[model samples]
Target: MVEIKEIEKSFGRLNVLKGVSVSIPSGKVVAVLGPNGSGKTTLIKCILGLVIPDSGNIIIGNDNVKNSWSYRKNIGYLPQIARFPENLTVNELFRMIQDLRKGYANIAEAERCKEELVSVFNIQSFLNKHLRSLSGGTRQKVNVILSLMFDPDLFIFDEPTVGLDPISCVRFKENILKQKEKGKTIVLTTHILSEVDEMADEIIFLLEGKIYYKGSPDELKLQQQEATLERAIARLLEKNDNKINNQLPGKNN
Candidate 1:
């Protein structure tokens, strides 16, 4: 559903992505896993056009992402942090989004999923409250609802479960799987290894601004000789650290 080719991005002196290339297939859930500053967020932002790459190209379906905004109509993006007017009630916010969505995409299609998602998240009681009055988890639920309301073909969720309660987290996972069943492509970044094991069909592990590993969770675990995805990732990071440390001057090989 999406293709990234030799994508690179640098900010003045710091390079965030170095020749990153990967393909996300349709109807699958792919997780991007990495530590801080590993380029996971940068890669996702490049696809979203929030951050333009210095080189390479991103193709969604058949069209290139450069000089194009229409492809976004097919994408539902849940940012790690969603900022909005705190004075607005949740219902008002939802209405505003529904109204704004009309300009770029099918508002009817977007509305079809709104009620179901709101019910799934059980945020009916919070809708009349202002955003500033809601707890962190409640706000995150609103974020999830707004993103999925579009019923887009592609879903990009960055740190999606950050403040979600256990019930809400479970609901989110189930919803994502249902979307996958409907042939929608999902890509997400998260630090939670258990979530990756449960929801991801494949994982693309990033380290030092590049893709260190890409495959099934089980495959990665077996390759790293670890019992769980978390341990496997830890081992991979440890190895990378040792490799870098050993290359330092006067260090043992």
Candidate 2:
């Protein structure tokens, strides 16, 4: 597990996180749903300490993030924007990241794992090619391979399936499920509603820098009188926003 309590973050005049709070249990896949400017990415950044929160706390496995920033070394993150120095062949990049990971965990066997993953993901064909020569989908595979390189305890991914082909997307989800079976916790955000319904054990709907709802997909659908998770989410947010508007200072409740 992980716990976030009333965490707030602001960038100048823009308040990205307005007292956001979420708790995720171990071995679960939690999906975050949101539209543009909804603070979903900001919340993830706060969790990773990439963006400092204005207040509140993030605790993971009994360790306070503020107290021990090193706790993050145990987590694997696949950021939305992945950048790498071009001209380096895929093999070289793998070696470099594996080397950097050694300093983080002092793992003596990381290179072995990296090679195995490269072959498993069918990335070997692209390994000798320079990064700039690969397609976007191939680059995405590389990004995912790198994030899962260490097989860290907690995996945080943003739009992980973007630019991937159908087969690759399915393979990626299968890998995530394998990680889930290993009792690893995962948090990710995606625009693909069907994938969220398929892979998520729980859902957190974020809107305007707040958690609109958090629960199982089944519970959400039945409550919202919808058969699909997508419709259910739309109903829930619409209902909540209607209530908010109804209670506005000059409006009738």
Off by over 4 Å in 1: 103-106
Candidate 2 at 165: error in angstroms? 0.6
Per lDDT, the best of the predicted structures is 1
lDDT of 1 by residue, 29-75 (tens): 99999989999889999999999999999999987999998899889
Q: What are the models' TM-scores?
A: 0.95, 0.91
Instruction: Encode model 2's per-residue lDDT on 83-157: one tens digit a residue.
Output: 888989998897887777676864555666677767767888888899988888889889998888787899999
Residue 115 of model 1 has an lDDT of: 78
Q: What is the lDDT of residue 138 in candidate 1?
A: 89
